[model samples]
Target: MTFESHGVSAGCWTGTLQSDRRPASLSVTHRGAVVVQAALREAGPGVWAVSAGLPPSVIDNGVHSLLLVVGDSVLASLTLVAGTVAGDDLLAEVAQLRAELDLLKREFRRLATGG
Candidate 1:
């Protein structure tokens, strides 16, 4: 079985799942817990349309990872970043990364302009 993500919209994640056999049970998990479960409907031969709602309880000021799973197998993942979830540590790390990136960009521009 293989799955192709169509991306998330309106707080729902969607994708096309292809399987030679019958469609399996689909569940959306977050933080090691099942958040949503939906039946996969046949879209075409060997194709299934998968959609699951992103639970509002999972939304908060932090990074959340949503997993599309069938049984024990994780087929896909979607990451959502909201406000400050990791506190100052993440902010500091991001600041450091941005500073390094700015330096790299400056160096790249200098080399490109032959300055």
Candidate 2:
């Protein structure tokens, strides 16, 4: 939720940082390479805005995670997934959630029936 101004979309990422003082540095990295060397600016008192453009190579199918760094600390991240892989991932997650929900419902019914 740090990225308030804009979330990852249109091959770009945006985030916000709130601190009492300005950070020494800010950047975005992918696989340890600096994609955004310095893309931070003070938006208001104790608030800063950061943004970066995602590379085309990392935009392909699979999970793409971008790290947002403030000073030397890894503050936030943006993750994108696409293609059939993304669909499969979502389906697996949904199946797991459904299993858990079914378990909860059964437990609730057993307790309700005083079994």
Candidate 3:
């Protein structure tokens, strides 16, 4: 239902999320790169607990987002949330898309250059 990261901090940070369905797994990232991916466990009716030792790739205090791909469709999504896969995963996905785009751009450049 709520996640709180207290004590001394020097990285990007955000907090708290409420989702409709429980997620089975979570992925974290910052600026579009896969950071942490871990299993989820139900903590309550609608709340799930994130495992400890989140990957270092997770942006601590960044504008992270997440996409929860459930069975066939995406069940939950979060943008501008703290963790990422749970909320940061979306950013990682976006990063993937960007990489694909860059590849396309390179191909176009090569063609234009008469290579």
TM-score of candidate 2 to 2 decimals? 0.62
Model 1: runs farther than 4 Å from truth? 84-115
Q: Name the runs in model 3 displaced over 4 angstroms.
A: 1-17, 56-115
Give the per-residue lDDT digits (tens) of candidate 1, residues 10-90: 888899999987645789998789999956788999999988888898776676667799888778878777875666756
Order the candidate numbers by lDDT, best to worst.
1, 2, 3
TM per candidate comes to 0.70, 0.62, 0.33
Question: Higher lDDT: candidate 2 or 3?
Answer: 2
The candidate scoring highest on lDDT is 1
Candidate 3's clash total is 13
Task: Name the best candidate (by TM-score).
Answer: 1
